[model samples]
Target: MKLLIVGGTQFLGRAIVTAAVAAGHEVTLFNRGQTGTGLFPDLEKLKGDRSTGDYAALQGRVFDAVIDVCAYYPRAVRELLAAVETKHFTLISTISVYASNEQLGQDESAELHTLTDPNTEEITGETYGGLKVLCEQAAIEMLPGNVLIVRSGLIMGANDHTQRFPYWTQRIARGGRVIVPPALDDAIQMIDARDEAEWVIAKV
Candidate 1:
């Protein structure tokens, strides 16, 4: 299968690309070419800027599946879907879309966080999840049954730029009194980058 991956330079995207390659599928990465440009030298790279809506480079190109990893707003996703409506679209959504303080083992059917204004430009950390919920809804509307929404939890592995879990991992590696946040053992679940990659590949 030929796959088009948006934002395939960073941690999770890189892992998905690697997994797709390992699975013997043709993979093309679409990004601004600012991060991990030196990593996948042999792979096909389609450069574009999502913030400024510069997707002219992707015109007339189609793929078996398009995995969107960097879209944060409804308009961003809407533009991409309008450009590539023929492909099976897989969106990388966050588990944070679920309402805060979720029940154990929530699935895709779980209630999502509320969004007052989906197109608002002032999206802060408090509104990230709600905005994502809006984005997911737009994706579903655009792609319908052809859309696969992979709700992911904390993603961690090499090449992680966020430094969220890696910080904790490094702290734990030191083997000292780690000042962890409250509810350290409260049923935390994380998806390894490789696992997420494999899952996406299989689904696609």
Candidate 2:
């Protein structure tokens, strides 16, 4: 299968590209060509910026599936959908879209947060979750039954620029007293980048 990955230089995105290549799929990446610029030297890498909606490189391209890993706003998703032609669209959403975390075992049916002003595009701690909810909704409405929304929890693996998991791992490896948060029995959920990437490619 031929796949087009948006932002295939970062953590999860890089994992997706690696998995796709290993699975014997033809892959093309569309990103700004900033970070990890020369990683995938063999595969095709097109230069474009989603912030300015400059998808000129993908103007006449088509793919079997598109994995959008950097869609934060509804407008950006809509613009990408309009620019590309693909049968399946996999949107990388987050569990943050949930309205509240008070309830246990929240699934996809759980209520999602909504912004008071839908037109507001300024992303902050307060509006990030609600904005993601809107972005998910936009993808679903635009793609109808052809969309797959993966609401991921904490993602941890190699090439993680945030160094979230690595921070704790290295700290604990120092072999000294470590400070842990309250509730040691708290259920933690995390998905490996390679695992997520493999699952996505299998679906494709």
Candidate 3:
């Protein structure tokens, strides 16, 4: 299958690209060429700025499936959908779309954030999840039944810049007095970048 991965240069996106290539699928990456430009030299790279709404690089391109990893607003998703019409569209959404973080083990049926007041600038934990919810909704409306929204938990692995779980892993590896959060025993679910990539590729 031929796959197009938007924002396929950072941690999770890079992992998805690697997994897709390993699975014997043709993969193309579309991004602003600011991150991981040196990596994945063998794969196709299309340059465009999302913030300025510049998608001229994808003028006459199409793919079997598209995996969006950097979309944070409904307008951005709408622009992408208009640029490329594909058979399948996958979105890398967050599990925080649920109304409250207190809710655990939530599935796709959880409540989503409103796009009316989405955060356009810097996205905090709260705003990021909310905007993602809106972005997912836009993609669903644009692609309808062909959309596959993968609401991911904390994504971690090598090349992770977030350093949320990596900080814990490093602390545990150092073997010292680790400061536990208030809810230490709370079930914290996470998906490895590779595993998430494999799942998305399989679905595609």
**lDDT leader:** 2
Residue 33 error, candidate 1, Å: 1.0
Model 2 off-target regions past 4 Å? none
Cα-lDDT of candidate 3: 0.84
The ten-residue window of minimal lDDT in model 1 covers 114-123
In candidate 3, which residue pairs clash?
none
Q: Candidate 3 on 1-204: residue-level lDDT in tens?
A: 989999988898988898899999998999999988899999889988888889898888889999999887788898998888688999888777777677666677877665445546457765777788888888989999999988887888888999987788779999968888888787767888888888888887
Candidate 1: regions farther than 4 A off: 172-176, 182-185
lDDT of 3 at 184: 70
**Candidate 1: residue 29 Cα off by (Å):** 1.2
- Residue-level lDDT of model 1, residues 1-204, one tens digit each, is 888889888889889888889999888888998998797788889888878888888888878889998778788888887776456898998887899655877777788898677568456887888888888889989988888888888888778889987787788898979887797677666778988889988988
Best candidate per TM-score, number? 2
- Candidate 3 TM-score over all chains jointly: 0.90
Clash total of candidate 3: 0
Candidate order by lDDT, decreasing, is 2, 3, 1
